[model samples]
Target: MRLDDLPLPDTPAARAALEVARRFHSPAFVNHGVRSYLWAAAAARSEGLAVDDELLFVSAALHDLGLEPAFDSHTLPFEEAGGLVAWVFAAGAGWTEERRDRAAAIIVAHMADAVDPAVDAEGYLLEIATALDISGRNPEAWDAEFRAEVLEAYPRLDLVGEFTGCIVDQAERKPGSTAAAAVAAGLPARLAANPLQL
Candidate 1:
């Protein structure tokens, strides 16, 4: 699906989340967030999995929010910090406690290497979308034309380099954090394996 054709939530919560993300994140990061949601939706359709668009959009939009200097935590991993910020935003947007908690789960789970659809469809979709965007993993799931359309709409802005740098910084600053673990686990090799050339 083209970026414009993807199913995006038009609810107040979604709009507020988008606005906040745009205001706080850099243009490249915001673009990446938008593409992540679109890709997640496309992946959900391809897999015949049901997803909550609002929850998924919110999760995807704010998944990397902790990378923003303002929200960066001294100890928490970016994923956890981002999830906390998202939970607060969701609650303020009048989401039920249950919904807000679920959103937090979705945001945090996106960092996992694998997500079980049976556990949380939104999280699973976000994982697939994020992996696709960051590393170009699972390229075959999306047709070349569709991928090109998404890239045209939201350019990469050298996201691989930018994101990797962010993780490297986090690793250096927070030795026991998830980013540090990712670095220790050979993040460079993973990025080399999945190149986003579109």
Candidate 2:
């Protein structure tokens, strides 16, 4: 798989979602979001998953929106808050009610331990893609050349330091959150040891 081989959805909703990611997230996060879409599309190709490109792209672009201060929730986990944001965005994009629910579900499932592709292909793809981006989990899942291309194009910047702080803050503030469990299970160390080498 190569960078050019990956599908980049160019729908109005997809473009607007990417713009929202750029407007709200830091550059590192924006890059991560974009990279996540590429990775997901690559995985879909490899696994023969027939995902809706526009839906996957939109979900990927806004998956981390709750981490932004403007959308951060005091009582809910970041993923949940981000899902609400996506739900609203989907409505504004003129998606059907069911489609809006699917978008929100995909955003929330990215933080889940796993998602069944048979049930939700988009969610499954987003989960694996985000895991790859954040922790370099299963780098073998993607072509090495493609991985290098994404890194070269996006540049990791200070993602490790920045994301570590974000998750840590979420953990401290919401002890029952998935972020808290991840932190308790040595997420920081895992992030530091990520094999991406970017």
Candidate 3:
């Protein structure tokens, strides 16, 4: 489905999160964020899972906030920093403490190897969505037409190259970081394993 045609939550909190993410992240990261949400939402629907749209939208929109130079923290891994940023944004948007925490948790867990849907539905969906975008896992889950439309709406802008570079930079700058671990575990191999044909 086209990005424009996809259903996005129109709540005030969702809008605020998107604005903050767009303001902080680069164009490429912003597109990645949006695609993450679209893919996650579609996956959720396919699985017949009930999702909190506002939480999912906020979590997905701000998932990469740490990649933004303004928010990048030398002390924390990008995932953790992004989660903190999302938590703060959600709190400021008048989200309840529980909701804010949930959003933060979802962002923090996106980097995990697996997210158990029974434990955290939003996180599981986000994980799958990001996996699909970054690693092309379950490419069959999204048909050719849907993939084509998403790409047409939000051109890649060399996402694999740019994102890989970002992760490598993080690894070099913060050896103790999750990005560093990913690099140590063979990021190049992972990227090759999940090639984006487009």
Among all candidates shown, the one with the greatest TM-score: 2
lDDT of 1 by residue, 78-196 (tens): 89999999999988998899998998899889888898999899999998888887766788889789888888888877676778889899999999887898789887567656656
Pairs that collide, model 2: none
TM-score of each: 0.93, 0.98, 0.91
lDDT (Cα) of model 1: 0.86
lDDT of each: 0.86, 0.92, 0.84
- Compared with the true structure, what per-residue lDDT tens digits does model 2 show for residues 1-198? 889887678899999998999999889999999999999999999999898999999999999999889999999999999999999999999999999999999999999999999999999999999999887899998989999999999887888988999999999999999999999988888888888754
In angstroms, how far off is 11's CA in candidate 1? 1.6
TM-score of model 1 (CA atoms): 0.93
Ranking of models by lDDT: 2, 1, 3
Winner on lDDT (1 vs 2): 2
Worst 10 residues of 2 by lDDT: 189-198
What is the TM-score (0 to 1) of candidate 3?
0.91
Task: After superposing candidate 1 on the true structure, give the runs of residues whose Cα lies further than 4 Å from its correct spot.
Answer: 189-194
How far out, in Å, is residue 73 in model 1? 0.7
lDDT of 3 by residue, 1-198 (tens): 445567779999888877887788777777888889988988888798999988998899999888778889989999999999888988899888998899889998899989899999999999988888877788789867888788778666767777888899999999988789878988756665674544
Measured over all alpha carbons after superposition, the RMSD of each candidate to the real structure, in angstroms, is: 1.6, 0.9, 1.9
- Which structure is stronger by TM-score: 1 or 2? 2
> Which portions of model 2 miss their true places by more than 4 Å?
none
lDDT, residue 57, candidate 2: 93
